[model samples]
Target: MDILSTVELNDCPLCLGPGLLEEEGGHCVYATCLDCGCHTVPVNYRTEAEKLDAAQRVAHLWNVGKVISEGVGE
Candidate 1:
């Protein structure tokens, strides 16, 4: 299984700012740091359906993950 398959916030590595953290990619979580202008993506977990159910959350996770790994948000 790829890194994404085994990702979960509980076991994730990076710790970012508050406000609903989400997966940043294969092994990361990204969040917009209000404290800092730089978009921050802390190494985190897979976007779980149960944990993150809203469309905005899902999309945000995807975008954040993409940005962290691929350097662009979709």
Candidate 2:
């Protein structure tokens, strides 16, 4: 999770709130909005070395408004 802190991200596109990088099961990374529950598609990684690139990919998706919001708010 420490490595994920290096990735920069934009504000949440759906709620304009703060966003952070999230790791799933120690194998994938994605960006998510803490306030609105919006998240980008997870990028899978096979090895520990690929985690950085995976984090960057998801960050890019999130920064460009490519996130998915399935909850009530838009």
Off by over 4 Å in 1: 1-23, 33-36, 41-43, 50-74
Q: After superposition, how far is residue 22 of candidate 2 from its true place, in Å?
A: 0.8
Report how far off residue 72 is in candidate 1 (Å): 24
Clashing pairs in 1: 24-28, 24-65, 28-43, 28-44, 29-42, 29-44
- Which of the numbered candidates is closest to the native, going by highest TM-score? 2
How many residue pairs clash per model? Answer: 6, 0
Looking at candidate 2, the ten consecutive residues that score lowest on lDDT are 65-74
> CA lDDT of 67 in candidate 1?
27
**lDDT by residue for model 1 over 1-74, one digit each (tens)?**
33333333221112343233445444444444332233433543446443333334433553444323233444
Which number leads on lDDT? 2
Give model 1's TM-score versus the native structure: 0.21
TM-score of each: 0.21, 0.89
> What range of 10 consecutive residues in model 1 has the weakest lDDT sum?
6-15
lDDT of 2 by residue, 1-74 (tens): 58888889999998899999988888888899999888999999988779999998999999899999988654
